[model samples]
Target: MERLLINIKISVNEKIYLKDPESSDLGKRILKHSIELIHSIGFECFNFKKLGKEIGSNESSIYRYFENKHKLLLYLTSWYWGWLEYKLVFSTNGISNPKNQLIKAIEIICDVIREDSRFSHINEVKLSKILIAEYSKSYLTKEVDDENKEGYFSIYKRLIIRIKEMIGQVNPKYQYPASLASSIVEGALHQHFLREHFPLITDCSDTKTTTSFYSDLVLKTIQK
Candidate 1:
């Protein structure tokens, strides 16, 4: 699955569209079209010709911005992370203290999962499997680095660091929770969004209310 991820990275730049939101650049125009197409038609149903027609561009023009569909999917997913990171960073303001920051961290991550239906757009485990497949098939492009997926990773690193940091602050000598505190919280959150929401409309295992219940449990666990 990871191999599929790397196999898909065709080179393109984000600024091609941002340079001018209106009639600015071919690259930007195609990128904007690509995102809208994916969101509207979904990953499985999207096609270049249909996308180009909708955007009033030719198929080759769309391909000029992205080599193919899968690569576009990768870029779009990464783009979401960029937007998310911006919100999270500003929301938390970089608190160094662990306990004080943990709540902010939880709020930042959970709020995104709950309020945004974006998570429902793709299956994370399947994507993770695809990421693993891509790694198996080939290596990631060098350009896909710190900025590429920082939004997704930074949240994980921040929580883990703060988990241990707060554990220490609360206990003065904290051991990593036997449960691996970070994963427990993240896993529960994932379940609420990924499995709990729908009977068949979603992969969610339980029901939508699971989020509220999980939130309360997490709060008590982290309470000082």
Candidate 2:
């Protein structure tokens, strides 16, 4: 950083870090441009030099926030998951019935993917692979790979357990545990939104259709 800025006689302003991160407005802007650029061309091909040139910033600016390409992708992927956790928490409150909760979870996931183009199978598959691969190492740094692991997982677990209990209520002789039901539910939703089921349903562009289909399918599948 010092070497690159030295040629232009630019000095590091400690106020940016020592004072307020908001002071690094240029750095923040560069990060935004970096996200846009990577989203367009993909993280594999996005070039900070080009991004800086297009955004009217220096290459050093992007590098200031992100050390390299890998770090940039990590930040972008993490940001998407962070937004997902928020939507999940907001979407499934006051709906405590296990059946309703499970349906709501699928519905909310579909609605979220509809709103974010990056939530497509391409990004979903990529992010899944990345998360699975990094989960061991990332969890070592904290309790989970994603930042809001406990907050989201607790509600999610409760919802799943409740759903399985509801299923058992309908079919008292069912042998499998609720945790297995949760796995099935999560897996089904993931397949639908992130795979072949998506392209077949163009009407699902709206949240209504998305949630409706998800809810109907979930209810039907869980019905005894």
Candidate 3:
């Protein structure tokens, strides 16, 4: 799987960046350090100037890649989704059982991220942390509708649809496949956040527990 992933390029929407960050060494540095900085300080306090200082690049150079921090967040989130989609597809590709496929998909999305050596510059672990804490800020804005129209959230929506189809295969007559699919995706993230910050309220203490919770919920909810 690492060999396959090393050859794959996680593509994000071209519209999200002024220049493709993956296209240059400096741009990749921007993405790498930005993830570290945001994970360390939180996105609310992150800025290009800070990122630039961390990467030892000029602020203007960072702007050459991303127009602003919000767009950078969008790019990061979109890239994460794209990378995850590949994992889901590859991991479940030959599984003929619908229920098994769905379980694997849930596990992939809900599992705690480990460092992927294929992409050395960008830390998948830190990026996952950012996604858990800062993903909503990427879309919950006044321009979200406009951004949606431009397909800013296409990869994420596509992932939900993939899960929705798996749900339908599991229970063809299920009335709320789409809702269940979306809930599983978003709910996993929320549950992870709760586990990390408010452990008393969430029973999920780790990745195994969280994956088990969502997999059980999904199977029960879609059972015929």
Candidate 4:
């Protein structure tokens, strides 16, 4: 899978960035350090100046690639989802059993993240941390409807659709496949957050527990 991913591009929507970070070294540095800086300082405190200082570039240079930090956050989150969608598709491609395929999808979505060597400039693990910590900020905005119309969230919505179809395959009569699928994806992130900060309130203490909880919930909910 890693070898297959080496050739993959994980494209984000063109409107999300002023420039493609993968096109040059400075652009890649912007993405690399931005992820590190955001992971280290949290997005509320993260800014282009801090990212530029970390990457040894002027703040203006960073702006040439991303108009502002909010757009940069969108680029990062969008890239992360696109990358995960690739993993989900590749991982579940040939599994013939609907139940087994859906199980694999859940596992991939809820599993603990590790650094993927295929994309060295960006850290998958830290990116996952950013997703868990700050993904909602990408779209929870006054302009979200406008951005949605522009297809800024298409990759994420497509992922939900894929899971929804798999759920239907598992149980043809299921009435709320889309809701259930979105819940699994969004709920997995919420569970991870709870496990880290509000452990007393969540049963998912780690990846295994989290994956198990969702797998059981989905199977039972859609059982014929």
Model 3: per-residue Cα lDDT over 1-224, one tens digit each? 55677678999999999999999999899999999999999999999889989998889999999999999999999999998999999999989999999999999999988887788888999999999999999999999999999999999999999999999999999999899989988988898899899988998974448899998888887784
Off by over 4 Å in 1: 1-25, 94-97, 112-215, 219-224
Rate residue 135 of model 1 by lDDT. 21
lDDT of each: 0.48, 0.50, 0.92, 0.91
Ranking by lDDT: 3, 4, 2, 1
Question: For all candidates, what are the clash counts?
Answer: 20, 0, 0, 0
Give per-residue CA lDDT, model 2, range 38-134, as digits (tens).
5556555767788888679788766666665554544544444444445554565566766665566565545434333422222443443343233
User: Candidate 3: where are CA atoms >4 Å away?
Assistant: none
- Measured against the true structure, the TM-scores of the candidates, in listed sequence, are 0.51, 0.50, 0.97, 0.97
Q: Write the per-residue lDDT of candidate 4 for residues 77-98, one digit (tens) a residue.
A: 8898898899999999989999
Model 1 lDDT-worst window of ten: 130-139
Name model 2 segments beyond 4 Å from true: 1-23, 112-213
- Please give the lDDT score for candidate 4: 0.91
lDDT of model 3 at position 210: 83
Residue pairs in steric clash, candidate 2?
Answer: none
